[model samples]
Target: MRLALTSDNIAGACEAVVAEMIKAAQGEAMPYGGDPLTEQVTKMFAELFECDVAVFLVSTGTAANVLSLAALTPPWGSVLCHPESHIVNDECSAPEFYTNGARLVGVAGEEAKISVSALEQAINKRMGDVHSVQPSAVSLSQVTEIGSVYSLAELQEISQLAHSKGLKVHMDGARFANALVSLGCTPAQMTWQSGIDIVSFGATKNGAMAAEAIVVFDKNLAQKLALLRKRGGHLHSKMRLLSAQMLGYLSDDVWLNNARHANAMMALLQKGMASIAGVEIIAPAQANMLFCRLPVGMAEALLAQGFSFYTGRWEEGVVRFVTSFQTQQADVEDFIACARDLSTSHTKTS
Candidate 1:
């Protein structure tokens, strides 16, 4: 079998998610999120966060993210985010388009996390300048682009600063489960309790096929987002399918179990790769994603050996490996063994 470690989304939908979808297909219910399944899923989210929340189900993380931003920011406003955040680098300006031209300001920071001081500077750069867009919201990526996770303390500090500056805090929780399990914190503590105003709660990366939710902590923003989602064309007519997937994912702690296993697999990879000569772990492997610096020859050899991953995205010689709920332990071991062999041969030749 090909050792696939490129992204968690490559994994097929878990059995529970598939079963839920099949079940939902058998019955005819209300359309356009007027169904009972959608309502139950909304309650599930509220309970998960330990507070009453408005949940908007969407088909993709990008939609959830941009819609949340659109609700929080106006056309003349600006959003502050880390330079390496998914919204800035990967979302293809959808946030800008959805907000009708809100600017995204990149704040420089280490380990893909925004520091409190840096965020303050960015927010205060032109507080009252008419020429510059006003800072309205700050977006943070949980299990950030480089695979590092922000601790609860870091999140609280940043959220506190943003709120003090009259800016809403939005978390792009594309790998939320992974980060949540890593921190061992409740969903509420990670979000609303940390002062986050909105969240793009993602399930597709974990196990669902194409389910994502825009979880609004503020009821007023939720009201606005309902219109934004409908306007953006993310309002699915057969919305029960998406709701079913999330229902399965969140039920019986399946999401948490899947994340724990994925994280464990990544930890194994991290330990194994660290012992290989010339393989440098470039970031903290806190969740299921890891970035490493590999020799060009080694990367090529692994690709030739049927190991699938990504390279040269962030920087030259850097590759990314992501584990999913379906990642097999044998495949991870095989990858490690292959890397060890390649490293030894290269060292001897050099």
Candidate 2:
């Protein structure tokens, strides 16, 4: 069995999501999210969020995030976010492209969660200045890139601060389900109720075939987001497949279940790694992702032994690991066992 500790995106579609896609494939879907299934999925999200909001379906997390920001930010505007946020570091300037030149200003902080003080500094540094990029909005990642989660209190603080400064709060919730299940909070409590104006609710990362939602809590922002999505070329034709995936993911609470399993397996891997030598967790393994540093050779050895994970540069001799919705306990144990053996071999050699 191959152990996977790469990214949640590496996991396959959940069976429920796949089955729904198959079911949708049999019908002629109304193009561009006009189908009844899309309406149902959007309604489910509004209910899950415990409020009336506008939802736009898209095919990728980048599209969801970029388009959501595009709806809120004007040209010559700037978005405040963590230095390591996916949109800042990984999206290849899709946010810039979508926002028609809105810039992303990286906030400095530990744990990959922006500190209110730091945000204040970043915002204050660019005030009343025509030459400086004006701060237009703030984006907070629910489960941050380092696998650290923002508590509701933390989100509230950030939200309050952003609003106080007249900046809209946008959440890049690529792992919204994982963070929700981890926090055990109602969707509203985690989002609009806490001052978030918009959210990029992701399904592709959790278990969908390929889908995400840009949810605008502010009714006024909805029309703009819909237009932006269409202009960005994300409006899907025969979009029922996308809606079907979300329908299955949310139906019967499969989304929560899959996220819970992924989180549990990460916990198991973390616990197992704690007992091994030369392994140190770089971040709290709260969600499906884990950022840990292991001995140099262990990554290579694990790959040789049929394990898969991204070994991000770990200083001089360490690497990172991740877990996903499909991670099995056996896979976790086997990877740990391999690490244990590698540790022993290294010790003997030294």
TM-score for every candidate vs. truth?
0.99, 0.97
157-199: candidate 2 lDDT, tens digit per residue: 9999889888999999999989999999988998998899999
Candidate with top lDDT is 1
Q: How accurate locally, in lDDT, is each candidate?
A: 0.93, 0.87
Each candidate: RMSD to true structure?
0.8, 1.2
Candidate 1 residue 296 Cα shift, in angstroms, is 4.0
Per-residue accuracy of model 1 over 1-350 as CA lDDT, tens digit each: 68899999899999999999999999699999999999999999999999999999999999989999999898999999998888988889999999999999999889989878988998999989999899999999998988889998999999999998899999999999999999999999999999999999989999999999999989987768888889899999999999999999999999999999999999999999998989999996999999999966999999999889997676889999999999999999999999999999998888
lDDT of 2 at 265: 91
**Cα lDDT for residue 237, candidate 1:** 97
State the local distance difference test value for candidate 2.
0.87
**For residue 97, what is the lDDT in candidate 2?**
90
